[model samples]
Target: MVFGANSIAFFMFAGVVARLLIMWPIGETSLKTWLFVHVFRPLFGSLNGSLLFALSFLVLSYIFMYWLYRKRIFWKV
Candidate 1:
């Protein structure tokens, strides 16, 4: 499996880190809201903005993963 345990764990850890540092912080903008305000709201309307943002984020994540794979930078257990 190209996407093995490390990949899953990396994403989970990233989510935790994002929440801890960015999303969950007091008086700060969460990633989703920032995307909506800056990128999605302008290109797509409010109704579809959130969904498109999520899809775009997923695509970008996969692209980053592929880049890391090409660089042989897989996280170890």
Candidate 2:
């Protein structure tokens, strides 16, 4: 479980860096729009123009972890 969580965190951090690289060069307005369309619309139906993909990913990951814990299933080594 610990190792799984660590790997998840590491990959998530790397994803954040990648998102920044993609979003930053295009400017804030474009980034915000892209995030809303790509990340928010798919999951929630409503647009989340304010939150970026990294932040949304973190929130979703936490929710998923909680669900997994409730089910008493952890990734085995």
Strongest candidate by lDDT: 1
Query: Across residues 1-71, which tens digit of lDDT does each residue of candidate 2 receive?
Result: 53365455446655775567466644545565576667677776663433545576567666666666667
User: What is residue 1's positional error in candidate 2, in angstroms?
Assistant: 8.9
Ten residues in sequence with the least summed lDDT for candidate 2: 1-10
* TM-score of candidate 1 against the unseen true structure: 0.58
lDDT of each: 0.66, 0.59
Which stretches in model 2 have alpha-carbon errors above 4 Å? 1-33, 36-51
Task: Report residue 18 deviation for candidate 1 (angstroms).
Answer: 4.3
Residue 38 lDDT in candidate 2: 71
